[model samples]
Target: MAEATEKKAKTKKKSANQTLVIVESPAKAKTIEKYLGPGYTVKASMGHLIDLPKSRIAINVEDNFQPEYITVRGKAKLLKELQKDAKKSDTVLLASDNDREGEAIAWHLKNAIQDKTEAKIGRIVFNEITPVAIKEAVKNPGEIIEAKVNAQKARRVLDRLVGYNLSPLLWSKVKNGLSAGRVQSVALRLICEREEEVENFLPEEYWTLDADFVKGKSSFTAQLVTYKGEKPVLKSESDVNNIIEEIKNAECKVVGIKHTDKVVRPKAPFTTSKLQQSAANKLGFTSRKTMQIAQQLYEGVNIGTSRVGLITYMRTDSVRISQTALDEVRDWISKNHPEDLPAEQIQYAVGKGAQDAHEGIRPTYVTYTPDSVKEYLTRDQLRLYTIIWERFVSSQMNNAKTRTTSAEIQAGDAVFRVSASKIVDKGFYRVIHLLSSKEDSTGSLPALKEGEALSATKFYPEQHFTQGPARFTDASIVKTLEEKGIGRPSTYAPIISVLLDRYYVTRVNKQLVPTQLGRMICKILVESFPDVINETFTAEVENDLDSVEQDKLVWNNMIGDFYTPFKNRVDEVMEKQESVKGFLDETTDKICEKCGKPMVKKLGRFGFFLACSGFPECHNTRSIPLAKCPMPECNGEIVARKTKGRGKEFYGCTNYPTCNFISHFKPVDQYCPKCGWFMVEKYDKKNGSYKSCINPDCDYLHSVTEAVEEAQKEALAKENQALKLAEEASKENQD
Candidate 1:
């Protein structure tokens, strides 16, 4: 029996000698495990095992804003498994993401599992999950950086203090279930201020005169640039008619011609913001969707025999590329497209505010082209990877050469100018032009000499209006946020998402429009917390957070500086601010059957609903009617409703069990002229706003330009009323 026990002890000792590696996700772990084959066990932590609780504000304001970190609920079993594995192994390496949040996660993991085992706990980081990167990280394990962890803690504490304190005040003052954030509030203000601008803007009428000219079997159209030897600003159709009448009988000729050669260089590799904007414009993807797809690409994706990370870290501001990647790409370009290769390698400039923690987003392997791995990826994955590959390869290529020719045509007292460009050398355009909006083909222009006669085919006059500033879309908002330094790479997508999820903003016609409740909330927040909710102050806080990450500033001091004044302001607002809860409620003609009280349209978490005016005495609510159902003699009403889990808005019939009618787009009150089907409002970045028939068989479409004109008129009247109110309020303050 003693001999048997000795053998079992020897077997246990051998088994306990293996090293355990912990990662943030199972996908990453599986890739690393395949790379590091024997004697190394890889397990996933599934993100942070211990984090601040979400139910309440878990910060100690008296203790220099210390956070009360706890094991995230539902993660206790996972933590135990990690501890058990650590107890059996002699070494444990925390291989989470390579960022400040990842560093904090690693630090928390070490502290939690360190006491449970005698194993050596360390940290390993790699931007890309490939065999080379993983092996190198394992060969040189390091400790978690304290400064990064502190920076993450400072941001979390600061956000908690601001959000937790201000949200309740907003609930009391504005409406229940409303929320506010340090960065998100600033974004809200931007949107609301823009909406005010749009409301107050008065569009001026404008006109332009154009004529089609034919010369040598080629036709071209050119705008009249100068009239009567001066630049024209035709503000009215009368002005356009006067010019057209003057130049109608004049002989047109190309009096002068000029040619110039130009060179166009490639753009830098993908930064987080640039990638989001490009995807939004080119692929019609929201920032949130782009990041989600990017995350999957960064994590390991199966390429045939094994899984490998297709791209480097996606959430980076730096445009810097690794030397190893640069060399490989340069070599690949030289062999694949030798003429496009530049004499020297190109390196992009890093931004002023970039921490330069990771290289810019690029493919991990140059040879694994998009076409080679097309079978393994989804359609979106293939498209995104193709662009990344094309961009990286073309960024290091030679400049594209083009020749532009400008012609000035003289007609009576007006000068019409036209220009055309022809590509001299494809260069980088050989690879990148496929993805760019601009093509490499030579422009269409007829060859003409100086003093050549041209025949006018037709005269055209176009009416136009000076458009107001456009509303923010997913692309423009992300670009604006990045330009103003309001948020970081990881926070950009989530900020927009939170606003939409909370009903603070609604996407109308693919443009973010402030709802009635949203505008009211912004008005209150701007008035109550002007100092903390502005862009400059919020940007300063972001800079200070970055400073803490670099160890130049302490985290506790940063939180103290923001929390003191901010808390005082919150207290003052809570005490002094008047409630505007019922101000936005619109009294409707419908009566509540349950309480015999008038029903009013009130804003709820999901959307507008009909609530009884007598709230305490009689509680009754139902979906507000939007339009009549278009089914054949169904006798049902369409109402706005939301989905179960995500609360996404949809319009459906009130008689759901009996009559099944639903649509993602809001139903319009009008019917299609041809098929008699109901119409729905739709918006796209390319097509602007319009109404379309809901029937699959009917293709009736109509532009909403007339509706927009009516809205503008209404907005002008409302603007005058708002100005009068402001003046009265000012007078009251003065008295």
Candidate 2:
């Protein structure tokens, strides 16, 4: 068979009249719609309309390269719509993002489009949303890059294998309601390990001494540096006190002064980490929350008057600004602050590990100010957009200037250093206020210079102890995850969500603290499955998956290496570990009521309970029942009740649902350890059949609330109100 004959018989060429353009998300539909005209049909895949199946573990582990593919359950309708559109169009244009994931999405779209038409399926990589970029992408339609596609497929299969194989094992061994994930488990392990470190840390006593001095019209503060003309490093309270006594009686005077010219540069536009931290500090948002809002802004937002993208791409970690965006920003700066704009553009070197030429974070459209979009956006959307816009704008401005003055005082051979900064110019700081913050309020040295003398106002001793490392929060975790390359932008939210749902970590006062369950899970992962929880292991797995996208390694080969050890471990645990119970987790605490013997507490299929120390011998076991109402003010005990036929037992309010107190597990008869409020049952219809007392009034609800967007909880309240109104209307009609 000749090659020409085979090509002719395999597929028909596309007609010149029809053109199909496929984008990644529905939210982007309108944004791209405006750019495209009538001859083209534009549709969104709603962000990867196809994905691996959830029900079973699908992997070809024997082969070095195995790729598992599945039709995501709900995307069928979306696929049908896309397929319909693709068939009608002569040419299919894959207009997804330029990243590896976007490339993978385009390939998947092609696989599912099912068009054998002569019009060839093509790929377009648009780095940005401007009209020129779009036009250039259309002109340079490329074939589906197979390496990126394989990388995505590799990641999908790897995650599926870990989840599918590990989740069931968790169900069997741990609490039935619990689940484990790949990236999520790693994140959980990290948080749990951090909590342990914080717990085990020992604080040491230490003290620092400072002195206040006055010269002419200027007052300055300095800290005690050393003793006998040498810096004395004191570690204990007694040592610091001894030094303080020597200095307390001695006369203090400024013996020397030093000055230096300084410039403070504005921070470059936000990378993913900086943006998350800023969002958290300024808006009291979680990293996930920031990302969600940024995604919506990136996709497109209806700013009432006009739909616009408030921010540039949010997934990037690079800090290289494009010359075009820089030029436009410089123009804005010159128009607003002629003094702030540098004589020429200040070109910053690309950050280490940053890719070439991809601009630093900036607003996609700089002209759209947050104030103008306030009425149209929610509080959160506006807050994030404002920060992004301001930061990007400031990045283009000139460096801020500061005048610095330093004075070293001598008090009987013990020296104290004082320093203060005065703003010479607001510079770029006027645009980026967060970067402009300065603590010193006093004016700089008037006529004072080096070798000048001044009188001492007062001296004071301050006592302090070294503090432990702070616990991980969502923002911190996101930073860690990105830095480690353990997960991607999309996985952060789902990872945090899963960790919380599994009770692997809990939030208290906005701090992420590992729960007992979370710690236990971490212990299990660390001790038994060290490879799975290891940061290096996770990053290596991710890298290999990235390689799959590059087509450098076969997906099946990755799974093969993973399965041998995994299966061996599973079998080993299945045989010897008859009960998915660990000695530490399943404790011998519960004293048997029948024999007064210590009974061990182990989690069974239904729930947690204490069985006789000698289970078969004593045969004395009973269900640990729910306790009294957790409400501190209420004086009622709870009883177990199943919803009519749903054999799932739940601890209900003794007040018969009147108090609305319920939980799948027995609520500890105490006030919420946090919030100081009543600990009530939390009933989640999807994924979670258990209950927790994560205080409804707490802000932690913000993170989890996003998880239940597909479910409606307050509907019953509205429904009941509507029902009551209808009943009253019937009475009014009769009257």
Candidate 3:
């Protein structure tokens, strides 16, 4: 520890002419340093330089959420490096992301940097890393926001309490290596619960009629909503047919005409959630992809002579606009879109329970649009910046006005309504009206009072089935988890990634489906530890953590309130020792070589593997191979195995030295129908996507992996989901 301190001291002795800014990422560092000019040097913390040691639950439950954080495993060296940098600079500025976690990182960096040098440490936050924002932020360096730091600490402590206390229960009830979290566990429960609901739902078949109507030259179609204002009182196609028969016999006439002109204002500027949702919808980019791209945009883009942050902070829940940016936007609207400007400045109202302290995400300058940087940015950079720019500008514009006309047709006992809305003025839509598939277009209609006759061409009837709840999309799941207060924004992706990484969940057509292992884990948590997944209990814990952040409560006390009862529950389970077992054991469709029956899964020191249920009789056990290796030389299959030494695992050729091939990679889990060797991915490090074979003995190889591209997207999407879950979990716990 003394040696570590010495390194930090040396780092603090840098000259005043040299200003070093430490951020959470190298990408951000590059962007900021470029904008700040020659006197400034930037470095990355590579994400939290200090964290609670992974080896233990470091919380003082009795001391009002007193946290005992340690330099996290594998981070000591990195922290030492930061300390050295700190000592070498006149002023050390912590420029991590602007969020609770980022604040904690900034605090940790202060300690890490100070341990090396006597140089002053300052906290600086730039909503955007552009030259103007960066300079302004540096000029007005604010003290570290303690509320954010406390919030982060509270969350960490709470997570440790939940994870450390509950994980042991999972080990006993579920399989080893399996664990649960305050956010992750709740998310799992939600998915599992939704899956159950879907399974239980009996789809009801109903019919709907669409009437194609013509008014002179224009033709429009409207779907049947209800019969006599009572929607779907009918259950079957026969009932729908009966309604249609009545409509056919009666003359179609307009009973009531309702027309109203309303302004459809633009949505608030991009909160992390809104940006992610829009990207998901518009670009088919996952939430993770959106953030990764946004991060690049926020950190900085190379613009001719200098690199700059393109957009404001990417992780925020607030819709509050920065006054300067708002002013620029207002000016742009007045000059370029006079008609779209509101009569007065439109102040967007933020939702209740939103974090409004942070500024809404927007481009650094309204004029320095994405197009201006097109030549310098990568493909993703352009797309994301465009989104940010459009969204910000739209947020300040006037509402779109529409002359809406609704016609209620009364056909004897059955009444049907069709509505049309015409854009009176483009308003905000002129700049950034997010076009959705269901958008309806309207125009001036002839003056028609109630009791007017209308002509219709063809009436068509269609059958429909009620859908069960939607499966969690990367976006929907994140939103749902957030609404329920399950987790922080940063955690959403990690939880999802962990589930998939651990083989607990699989994405089938972008939908999360619990694998057998995932299902088993859920069942165990539910049966053995019901409290872990309790909605109110989970939500309360999250709220409690938030309370700690707001300084309304102490972290240690929060942990104590939770850990005391939780520890008791865990201990009780251990002492009582319910020899609870799986009802339907793991089974594989793989044909058993000896026995005719399919192989049944057997529990072992490693994990669930295929073994003859007639163990004593057959005595055959084999690793559940991902795919059979087809390499003629190795003739080995890819099996999930832990690596020795460094614990870094990879697929090895069963043929050993004769076929010396190994892969540290995720398997496609597909077998070569002809060769039988599992195809592995590789990269030249220069080009991109490189798919190869796990068996070293095999000569097969393929590339074009686009590893960074795939990873960036997945990472961002995971981050988004994790963040939502974490935020929700925090709220739930805190409440």
| Top candidate when judged by TM-score against the true structure | 1
Query: 343-420, model 2: which lDDT tens digit per residue?
Result: 888766655444332455678777776666778888778878889988888877888777777877787768888777
Per-residue CA lDDT of candidate 3, range 1-735, in tens? Answer: 999998888776532367788888888877777667777888888887778877777777656657777777787887777777777777877888777888999988776667688667889886777777778888877789787787787777777887887777767765566667777766777778777875555445556777865656766666666676677566667887887777775776777889889878788887777777777767777767787788778777678987777787777777888778878889988998987777777677876566565788888878886667889998877877888888889888877788889877766676777777777677777765345434647533455568766666778877555555766767777777667766655666676776767666666546776776667667766765787676677778767766776778876666666677777877887777564457436777777878876788765543467888776878887777766555555557667666778665566655566766556675785543335556654534243234665555566655222333445677789999999999999999999
Please report how far candidate 1 places residue 79 from its true position, in Å.
Answer: 0.4
- Listed in order, each prediction's TM-score against the native is 0.89, 0.74, 0.74
- lDDT, model 2, position 294: 87
- Alpha-carbon deviation at 78 in model 3, angstroms: 3.6
**Which of the predicted structures, 1 or 3, would earn the higher lDDT when compared with the native?**
1
Model 2, position 495: C-alpha lDDT score: 81
Alpha-carbon local distance difference test for all models? 0.87, 0.70, 0.72
Assess candidate 2 and give its TM-score to the true structure: 0.74
| lDDT of model 3, residue 607 | 47
lDDT of 3 at 261: 91
Superposition TM-score, candidate 3 onto the true structure: 0.74
Which lDDT tens digits does candidate 1 get at residues 250-333? 899998899999999988989998898888888788889999889889888888788989999999999999889989999999
